[model samples]
Target: MNLCMIGTGYVGLVSGVCFSDLGNQVVCVDKDKDKINLLNKGRVPIYEPGLDEMLKRNFKFGRISFSTDINKAIESSDIIFICVGTPTSKKNNSADLTHVYRVANDIKKNIKKFKIIVTKSTVPVTTGDKIEKIIAKKVNKKKFEIVSNPEFLREGEAIRDFIYPDRIVIGTQNKKVNRVLKNLYEPLVNKGAKYLNTSRRAAELIKYASNAFLATKITYINEISNLCEKIGVNVEDISIGMGLDKRIGTRFLRAGPAYGGSCFPKDTKAIAIIADQYKSNLSIIKSTIKSNENRRNLFKKRTFQIMKNKIKNKTITFLGVTFKANTDDMRESMCLKMIPVFLKKGAKLRYYDPSGKKKEINKKVKFCKNIQEACLKTDLIIIHTEWNEFKSLDFKNLVKKNNFKIYDMRNIYSSAKMKQKKINYFSVGR
Candidate 1:
């Protein structure tokens, strides 16, 4: 299969590389000349595990290529994947579809032969229909089929998620389009990956619904953890007890500051806005958004309380600043919110992350060179993201230098062990 993937962002770049590795000739097109040049040199702009190596291998094998020519890409492929970004609109909190729409217009001008346009971006319900109408305005209806094929790749583990997806949802009413997509994903389909065919609207809604439900689950457990803390019950045991059940299998049950990522924060807000536009109410989702916001402040308050409200002149180090582990994405990260608060409170701050970009970090915060430097001479240590390096730190050495006050936001440490070292420890819900 020959595929044209537009917008070489996280989803586009990862999917194009993976699909090319599966023996499909993929042309990844982006308007950014600098990014295209970088990819052509066997370098990727983003930090995804194993992506740079895989991209190089596929490019070397002549199975994949990068280009700035959208017209040429669309002309050469039978299937075009719109993997553009639909970031949250700042004006109304709805999904900003400007990029998606712009791609549609580009396709309208360049599309010639019969093609199947798949929306690999997370979009609202009926977006496929809108794209179809936009294309039909210029091209004949018989020349194309709009398919909603939303991606469910997690940032840190995107390659694994793409290669071994639990299920692939193909949203199209056209039987021909369904069969074509099945053939395109035949490699995974043969590996026992379930390919579910549903209406386009359902597929679009499935992406948002799944994200919103997961965000709600995280918020639910965070709230439960708070109650457990007040009542002096260990939330870890509660999480384990609940996870052992068949119905409530534990996944997002581990509580923390809150759910903050590119997907959850933006998608939850987009869905709530979508519900309101439809004259419907998603009260639980609305509350989840509010609860997440409140949790950030609570995290700050908890840190102050741990320091006996004497944050001024305190030296603190944040172990990880990214939203979650395994990726360098800082969008909606708790550290983004908490860092300013700490600085305002007159606390000297140091931060370190294995994958976070130095350019994305705030100028006010001191970026540490390594774990030893970050942990040394700090009044307190806070673990934001559960990065693997932070899980097995030399706590004894850290405690010997610092005040021995540690806040494990991700619960990556054993409280019993911290206590054995005579360190004051604080963790979420435990």
Candidate 2:
């Protein structure tokens, strides 16, 4: 399969690399010449564990290439994947398809041969129809088949997810397209990945619905952690008890800060707006959004309580600042919202993430090169994200501060252990 991934963002880069690794020739096309150049120079722009090695291996083998020229990549490939961004619109909260449409228009211009145009990006329902219409204006329907194949790749675990997806969804009723896509994914299908073929709209909705439900699960657990905090219970035990059920598997059940990755917050809001557009009320999802928003403020209050309401001149350090561990993405991270508040209250702040310093953070705060630098002399240590580097730390020796407090928002540490160490430790639920 000769594949061209339009937009060499997280989705496109990972998918193109993996497809190339699977013996398919791939070209990752991005408008950003800098990112393309970085990839071509054997440097990855994004941080995903083991991605650089895989991309380099595929590139060295002459199986994969990165390009800024979309027209050349499109002309060279049989399958063109639109792996662009469809972020939530600030105006209506629906998915902003400006990038997707622009790519469609670009594809329309360079379809000299028959092509399989797959929407690998997360798009709203009927987006495939709009993309088809856009391309149809320039080329006949016979020249292209617009299929919706929304990516299920998580940011940190993209490589594993692509290779071992639970399901490969192809959204098209065209039997020829279906057979070709099935054959394209036959390697994974043989690896026990279920192949599901549905209508284009269903595939689009499936992506949003899956993200919304996962967001709800995270919100549900966080709310449970709040109740557990009031009643002296461990949210871990609650998570375990609920997860024992075969119906509700134990994923995204950990109590933590508000769900703030690239997908959850944005997709949940977009889907709620989508439901409203069809004259339907998604009360539960709406409540989840509201509750997640409140959770951030609650996290700030908890931090203040840990500091005994005296934040002035206090030195605080964040162990990790990204939304989750192993990814450099900081979009909608709780720390982004909390950092300014802490600075305004006269707290000197520093943060260290394994993925390195974040530009999203306020300039007033410091970026530590290492965990020890971030923790040294800090009055309070907040384990914001459960990065592996922060999991088993000698905080007593590291902080070197008497009576310093530790707030385990992700509950990465055992409260009993912290108690035995004679250190003041706070956790999500218990």
The candidate that wins on lDDT is 2
Clashing pairs in 2: none
Residue 14 Cα positional deviation in candidate 2, in Å, after optimal superposition: 0.4
The per-model lDDT (C-alpha) reads 0.92, 0.92
Question: What does the lDDT come to for candidate 2?
Answer: 0.92
1-430, model 1: which lDDT tens digit per residue? Answer: 9999999989999999999999999999999999999999999898799998999899999999999999999999999999988999979899999999999999999877899999999999989999999999999999999999999999989999999998999999999889989998989988888999999999999999999999999999999999999999889999899999979989888989888888999999999999999999999999999999999999989998999989898988999888899888888899888888888999999998898546766788899888888888788999999989898888768646645689999999888887887788999897
What TM-score would every model get versus the actual structure?
0.98, 0.99
Off by over 4 Å in 1: 399-402
Candidate 1's displacement at residue 170, Å, is 0.4
Looking at candidate 1, the ten consecutive residues that score lowest on lDDT are 395-404
CA shift of 147, model 2, Å: 0.4
